[model samples]
Target: MKREDLLFLPISINVTNKKILLIGGGKVATHKGTIMARFVQNVTVVSPEFTDEIRKLPFTFIQKEYEKGDLEGYFLVYAVTGNHDLNAQIKADAEELGILTSVCDAPLLCDFVSPAIHKQEHVTISVGTNARDAYQAVAIRNQITNLFENGTLHI
Candidate 1:
């Protein structure tokens, strides 16, 4: 089956206290960590190099190359290292362990796609395009946020 044909069932998962492994510390990884930190407290980032922004985050940061067993004990994994080979390997490892995985820029290898999220108090809205178009998802999410702010779309 084609990657686009793969269906994603949208659902909310409770990540509080659940282990999360982030395999990268660059711009994309930083963004992912920032978003995840909002919902979960147990996030660990592994990478050889990290941006200053990521260093300031509260999550535990491991300044080393990702190892094979890094996915152990993690409930979810985000492979955003920008290295196709590394991301693929990470995806394979995580899937083998029966863990949910999201490989940045590689939807076919991912078990889940992180959506563009808009949060307003207790209400959170997410927009996604099955990893086909991130810009479009962000634009749609922004439009929805505007509508909510203007009281046009009441929850």
Candidate 2:
């Protein structure tokens, strides 16, 4: 249940063609939603307002506030809202619905935490500190990137 537990964990789950629900429309939400679009079957974003970046993405957009009922039957949920109370509440609701939830910037309340990622040609590396020291994780990932690039570490 601690953030440190997520460190050095192996993650191979492919999210392609999964239903991902993103709750928020600001920069943070937009970033999360856009990333999910790479593989998720569909990304649904529910928020009152959106930035140009969010609007331009190829995903379902629902312009609305966070309602308790909105957290029903999604494969995954990301609560990135500016409203702390709503995020917490939605996280709880998602849990009750047996849906996996990740709360951006609030790892303690998340079932899954996003890790700092490093990408190379035909290679992707993810380093997570379980929400502990993200900066340190990123640094470690950079070193791994160097090794991988030089063929010292093979995926």
Candidate 3:
């Protein structure tokens, strides 16, 4: 099915105590890791190599290649490895285990898409294009942030 054909439901999930797994150590993976760490207390990142940014994060890091059953105990998974084949395998494994998964740059393989988020105190705004147009989503998020900064939109 096409990405546009799917109807994505917008909802918030509480990952306070959930186990989150990130399979990658590159820039893309680091970005996802940083965002997930903000809400999830139990996050483990597995990768053979990592960028400097990810090394600074407080999450547990397993410096090794992802195995077949890496998604076994995680409630959610983010597959951001540069290798498309590995990412596909990760998605397939996560699905088999009924775990929610998001594969970076591949919306069709993702169970859910991550949105461009803007957070201020208790207010949080998210803009997404169903993984169809990331540029447009970021632009919209920036617009919303500007509105809030200019006091055009009150909290």
TM-scores, all candidates, are 0.94, 0.81, 0.94
Q: lDDT per residue, candidate 1, 30-140, as tens digits?
A: 899888877876889999999999888889988899998888899999999989999999988888899999999888888999999998788989998877888999999
Which runs in model 1 stand beyond 4 Å of their true positions? Answer: none
Give the poorly placed runs of model 3, Cα more than 4 Å off: none
lDDT of each: 0.90, 0.81, 0.88
Query: Judged by lDDT relative to the true structure, which candidate is superior, 1 or 3?
Result: 1
Q: What is the C-alpha lDDT profile of model 2 across 1-155, one tens digit per residue?
A: 66555543557566766678999999998878666655453888899998889888888899998887787657889999888888999998898899889887887888887777777656767887668887898899889888887999886
TM-score of 2: 0.81
Please give the distance, in angstroms, between residue 79's alpha carbon in candidate 2 and its true position after superposition: 0.1
Instruction: Give the better candidate number (1 or 2) by lDDT.
Output: 1
Best candidate per lDDT, number? 1
By summed lDDT, the worst window of 10 consecutive residues in model 1 runs over: 1-10
lDDT of 3: 0.88
Those runs of model 2 whose alpha carbons end farther than 4 Å from true positions after fitting are 1-9, 142-155
Per-residue CA lDDT of candidate 3, range 90-126, in tens? Answer: 9998888999999888888889989988888888889
